[model samples]
Target: MRHLPVLFSAALMMASTATAAPHVVASVVPIHSIVAAVMGDKGSPELLLKGSMSEHRAVFTPDQIATLGTADLVFIVGHGLEAKLAQISGSEAVNGKTFIQLSDAPGIIKLPVREGGAWEPDDDEPAPAAGSEAEGVLAFDPHIWLDPENAKAMAREVAVDLGKADPENAAAYAANALAFAAETDKTSAAIAAELAPDKGKPFIVFHDAYHYFEKRFGLTGVGSISDVSAQAPSAERLGQVRDKIIAARATCVFREPQFDDKFVQAVIEGTGAREGVLDPLGAGLTPGPKAYDQLIGNLAESLKGCLGG
Candidate 1:
């Protein structure tokens, strides 16, 4: 105190005295969880969107950009999962910073991020111009965690990236990733077994978010309730879906965790088909240990309970 310091410079000095840990940011909850698991004590993880926030409609707040500008690494579910993430990665603040896209990782079965409508068969992929779903660009489905195998691959990639970034603690990073991968494998096996009795059965979902899930579990994506992220299907589309639901004898009508069930309920009206949520983002998802496990567990159990044994 006797040394007498300037206010601004003293503040800077105080900040300098306190160390800032390596910053890792993710675009969505699952990516955040994977990165957080890998970083463990190596870094503190920040998420741009919570579980309830739709990645498709995500916007960057000024503070979010400021935080992102300082991140050591930013994890994204690449393959055009979230268009905003690609925009952010190209920004001056993030230009050369390490941005890892999970879709490019190995062992992930990705599909074109588009919706097929009875109207035109399929629509264009979502674009970023305020409201654009034109030209049908091949955006990657960022919902990689739906398939536990992809989740394991993502964990390993996070490990490699973290270990490379912080070589001093590479061993710890590897250990965390290894442990997370093992957990993911168990989850994958459990989900497979849970749906095994109903394998090859067709089902109707609200959106196309579960393409990887269908492939993993050997089920048919009979139809969908939504035409795109921002647009709900018209009555005509719903009518076709109703016919398909009846034809497939689909026992369950699945709605996403965050969307309203009105349309799905409407589709199933008078047809004996029951409706429930199939949450990839795991709505009401608690942020703690066993939370991710519970999210997937609830999804499988919910599906089995609705569909059949």
Candidate 2:
């Protein structure tokens, strides 16, 4: 009976070890949605930033930093999107923690940072060559998750890393990734069809954050009111954008949920351009397996709504 108790205890411990989920952390809501989808029912990944927090301006609490230090894996958009976490995760404080930069994921297309507010054709600066620095600043557009294809690529990476970390749930993760990819494809096609009528219509965004989404759908973005940093445009800059809005016959001026709309109003004031709201972060939507689809869908609806048929 003594031996049976010992054997039972050993079996219980082994079972617990075998079934425990990996401690994974995701930086932003969109990334969290993808990770959650890939993890499926096997495990849940912890989300770092929540509810419309801009990745560029994200400020982490001390408890969040501690969470990073103890996580088995951390997924982030590396190219300076979550600058604070990126800097902290590299230090010895989180030594031995596996931090996966989905920006570096193979097959994800990265666009260069647009040089000026009005992103004229001449303002398209090429992305910095690999392994070479660009004036010690963020070089590529860090909003890779805006593109469904890019999201698919991120999901594959999350699956691979999660599978490696939790061997017991490897097959489940792989299957979920495949399923998520299919869903993204269907979602992309639907969005493309929804945005077809709005193609070639001139529009202005609050910032140049939607290049990936614009490029993916062949949408016409005449210019942005703010820089990549999302700062409010100066009066001179607003005047310039207002002129462009008139010249381009822009259909709408789109403001982001995370930014102040006063600048957008200033740009469109007396320009006869309607104002619309777009959220790239899925901030208004609940984070979960279907959040990415909802995010992309909402953006399309917003664009089509303002641009008109």
Q: Name the runs in model 2 displaced over 4 angstroms.
A: 1-17, 92-98, 120-138
Residue 83 alpha-carbon offset, candidate 1, angstroms: 2.2
Alpha-carbon local distance difference test for all models: 0.67, 0.79
| Worst 10 contiguous positions by lDDT, candidate 1 | 1-10
lDDT of 1 by residue, 1-309 (tens): 011111122232345312434556777777777777777776668877775766665777888887777666677775445656556564665534446777777666666665444322333422336534222224555566777777778887777776655666778888988888888778878888888887766678887677677778776667777643434666777887898888878788888766778888889998878887787775577653345667678877877887783
**Residue ranges of candidate 1 with Cα displaced over 4 Å:** 1-21, 92-98, 112-140, 227-231
Q: For residue 155, give model 2's deviation from the true position in Å.
A: 0.8
At residue 143, give the lDDT of candidate 2: 78
What are the models' TM-scores?
0.81, 0.87
Q: Each candidate's root-mean-square deviation in Å?
A: 7.6, 7.9
What is the lDDT, from 0 to 100, of the residue 296 in candidate 2? 91
The alpha-carbon deviation from the true structure for residue 193 of candidate 2, after best TM-score superposition, in angstroms, is: 1.0
Per-residue alpha-carbon lDDT of candidate 2 for residues 1-309, written as tens digits (9 for 90 to 100): 000000112233354536777777888888999999999998788989988788767778888887887776788877667766655655656653546778878788888877654763222333333543222235688878898899998898888887766777888899999999999999999999989988999999987789999999999998888766554456667777888999999989999888778888878888889999999888889888898899999999999999993
Q: Count backbone clashes in candidate 1.
A: 3
